[model samples]
Target: MKLDRTAIEALLPHRAPILLPTEVEADPATRSGRALIRLDANARIFGALAQPALAHELLLEAAAQTFGIVIGACPPEGGAAAGAEGRHLLLGFDEVEFGPAALDGGAPFELEVALEQTSGPVHVARFSAEQGGAQVARGQLQVFNG
Candidate 1:
């Protein structure tokens, strides 16, 4: 199912400024989805969040939040650890590759992702961040149920 902005916000723990999933199209049955992220560097509060809008780094958090949406679709009896709490943690990253800038000025990008339940409460999510028809970054994120 495709989640609108309202639904996406409901499934994610993050809020504006830090919230990266602007739009997400997900298939809960497969624990896969694509998220459109538009970073707003200006949304910072009192310069706390001020920094260069780095797409490669921010893409990782976006991918994790996107995976959370699809994970919400799994039933309690299923292997998904997220359950109904909508609580999950991004543990770490692995095999991350930083590529040339797909575009300057922190252009919006879409990340296609798939998640696998590796073990109890542990999940591995793979994602490809693309912008301007070119890939900006690709990596796997380690996640676990909260």
Candidate 2:
């Protein structure tokens, strides 16, 4: 499923100044998705610097939120939606690496995430981030969707 910004707002509990993922191409069945975050010089996370850039750590946030989309959009077997109202939390990261942004000055950041494993409320996912088609970060994330 593809989600535009407005649909994202309805499903995600985030607003500007911190909202990531301007768009999403998510599939619960596939347990994977692409999340895109586009920024301009005036974007809040980067402050008022002449050129804006999202800090490396925030890329992890994008991964987490994108992962949430997959987990949250699924229909529960006999209950509420897997993507139902719940707390999505970051638990840990592994083999994560960061490289310099390919496009500076607040360009678009895209994250491709695939769910790796899950046990009850805990989930593991691997993600890679790219800007201008160049990888900026890659890692595995452990999260809690409780």
**Any runs in candidate 2 off by more than 4 Å, and if so which?**
14-16, 41-43, 46-54, 76-82, 100-105
lDDT of each: 0.71, 0.74
lDDT of 2 by residue, 1-146 (tens): 88887777666666455667788898767678998866452246545632234466567777877787666665534657666648678898899998774446467888999988878888899999988888988999998877
Q: Kindly report the root-mean-square deviation of model 1 from the true structure over all alpha carbons.
A: 3.1
- Where does candidate 1 stray beyond 4 Å? 41-53, 74-86
Quote the positional error of residue 142 for candidate 1 in Å: 1.1
| Candidate 1 lowest-lDDT run of ten | 42-51
The lowest-lDDT stretch of 10 consecutive residues in candidate 2 is 45-54
Whose lDDT is greatest here? 2
For model 2, what is the error of residue 98's alpha carbon versus the real structure, in angstroms, after optimal superposition? 1.3
TM-score of each: 0.80, 0.82
Q: Residue by residue across 65-87, what tens digits does model 1's lDDT show?
A: 77777777554444545457447
